[model samples]
Target: MDRQLAERLEIFERTGQVAPEICRFVRTELDVLDAAGSEITEESAGTLTSHLLLALQRSRDGGALTEFAADETVRAELAGHPDALEQAAALAERAESALDVVLPGQEVRFLALHLALLRQREAMR
Candidate 1:
């Protein structure tokens, strides 16, 4: 992990704004992305990391976004990137298993959109 991301994770962990499990999940997910040759860095994955942290925290607190409406444009974009969608769903499943919280379908779709964007950006480089 980059210094900036490590520092941010430390702050969240120390402040208790995010649970230890969530932090661990974020680290693990980032590691997975790195190992998969995604060239993940704090700048690249910051938003996705934040989103995952908040999603996990909300799920654990019973404040999960149950009424999320999937954006059609994003859905259409993801349809062309089945691999990203599948990878995002798998990552979400890991988060669910790690934190013992279920993510709604819309949340998974949003995650897929983010993942697809990240991969697309990386591909552009």
Candidate 2:
């Protein structure tokens, strides 16, 4: 396991809590992903986009989404909007690519898992 992920898991094990904002984001994203198992209408797409924007904001501010975490809803929305998908894919790919620089190879599996989840989410689209 990645050290960072391991540490995070430990922290959760010990504290039984994550940042409130992160928890909210994760729950919302996961619910959206679960909802993706059905049709992704325009209204759903708008909701997904709103959540992604929120996730992006959190990420930009150095907050982690380890608690709730983003899911496949992002990809589903992208499928609905090709242009937006392209933009989001680019941004996500960039983030994935930069993981090594960001973490210096410590617990890299955690990063891979994150990217994999994002890919799974995208695949839903």
lDDT of each: 0.81, 0.40
Highest lDDT: give the candidate number.
1
Where does candidate 1 clash, by residue pair? none
Candidate 2, residue 117: Cα displacement in angstroms equals: 15
**Clash number for each model:** 0, 4
Error of 2 at 7 (Å): 40
- Winner by TM-score: 1
Report how far off residue 23 is in candidate 2 (Å): 23
Put down candidate 2 lDDT per residue, 14-125, tens digits, no spaces: 5644344443343344445446463333332333333443444445456636442344554443444554344345445544454311221211222334334455555777
Which segments of candidate 2 are over 4 A away from where they belong?
Answer: 1-42, 69-91, 95-125
TM-score of 2: 0.27
